[model samples]
Target: MERLLAPVKAFLHGETPSSWIEEARRPERLAVVLQDHLLCELKAAQTAVWLLRRYALDKGGSERLKGWLRPFEDRVYRPCLVKEHQAMASEVTPAGLSCRPDAPLAGPLVEKMVRLIKEELHHFEQVRTLMLARGIVIEPIRASRYAASLMQLVRSGDPWVLVDRLIIGAYIEARSCERFAALAPHMDEEVQRFYVSLLRSEARHYQDYLALAQMASPEPIDARVREIGEAEWRLIAEPDALFRFHSGVPSAL
Candidate 1:
């Protein structure tokens, strides 16, 4: 944990605010925390699929990937589709991930992202199961501005575009890892254990994204990283109207 924290701590510009942690740990807010956590897991996998579709896969591969994700989206968006797609939840298989021969860094990108997609889907299922056991229903909420705000800071065009996306991915994963570690002690036993279990992969996801960004870029990324890290810090440190899992400090505080 010490070794992992060194890079992640340096990578992000700020810690999860004390006020947000207080809000997250409140008994009345557990449902909101779990609900947003569950949806973020889904969004992470969907983003992985999108990356593969745009940068790695060919036309046919992209279509097939979309077909594969339809059921998951259906289940997520509509409560009625949950039972129908429940069986498919446990069936995430990266058995047939195909990448374009001409795609840059094809093998590494596909391998890392496919694994990420599978793990994220599995995590999604776990969260949903826990929700069901607690009689909590999955409801859609407006997304927190954190991710889109990070994306806005990414530079426009070419290798920089790709590098910026990768860097942003790293920041997101790092923040999630940090937040999980921060929140664990305050949660119920099951939730605490789940968050603890998540730290390892979440840390790795940040590393993989950064490594991929370096591979994809021809120039140094240190300055860009620091610049974006500051943006991430501001996003987390600011007051917010909504209090989703990844949201900033609660306004009521």
Candidate 2:
């Protein structure tokens, strides 16, 4: 815990305002935050699935990948497709995942990615359970601009391909961790507890993604990480049109 606190303390000192914590702890804000939180988990799972399919797997493997997510996508992921009062009670399990020749990936990369997918899916379920308990209806909202903006910077082809994707993943995980820390203190006890519990996992996920990026690429990752980190910091600090979990400082919406 001390090791975790070292970085988080530095992060909080540098990026978060003191008053923000007070504002975040209010019980009145939990519903809105939780709604965003739930959506964020879905998006995380979706992002991991997309990355694995695009970079690590072959066509047949990708189809199998999509199959793993199809049930959730059909039921819980796209909220607009289902009745407001109705929720899917069954859970989908991903099975028989293995590397393919057309896009052979390293074992460690595959293992880490598959584990992340499972964790993200589990988190999606947890968020759904919280929403059900709180009577927070799941609705499709327009995605925040954070991801699209970062993706626009991805260089086309080969080495850049892996580097850019991994950089984006790091940014996403970092931002999610930042927001969880930012919002947790101001939330109701239940929500605060949940968000606080999430801090360690999210922090580790960011590191894991960054480490994988470094391992996959021959180029030095530090400079790339620094460059992307600066860009991410701008996205977070600047005014924005939306207020999804990863969105920048809320504009007048």
Residue-level lDDT of model 1, residues 86-180, one tens digit each, is: 44534555557677888987778888987887788778878988998999878877888999888887677778888999999999999999999
Candidate 1, lDDT over the whole model:
0.84
Please write out the lDDT profile of model 2 over residues 1-253, one tens digit for every residue.
Answer: 4566456444321364343343344555556566766667767777777877776666766777676666556545565565533433233333455555655454555667776766666676677678789887766667778888888888888778877888788778766777677676566677778777777878877777888888778878877777777787777777776655666666675
When summed lDDT is taken over every stretch of 10 residues in candidate 1, the lowest stretch is 84-93
On lDDT, the leading prediction is 1
TM-score of each: 0.93, 0.83
Count of clashing pairs, candidate 2: 5
Q: What C-alpha lDDT values do all the predictions have?
A: 0.84, 0.67
Clashes of each: 0, 5
Q: Which residue runs of candidate 2 sit more than 4 Å off their true CA positions?
A: 8-14, 17-29, 77-95, 102-104
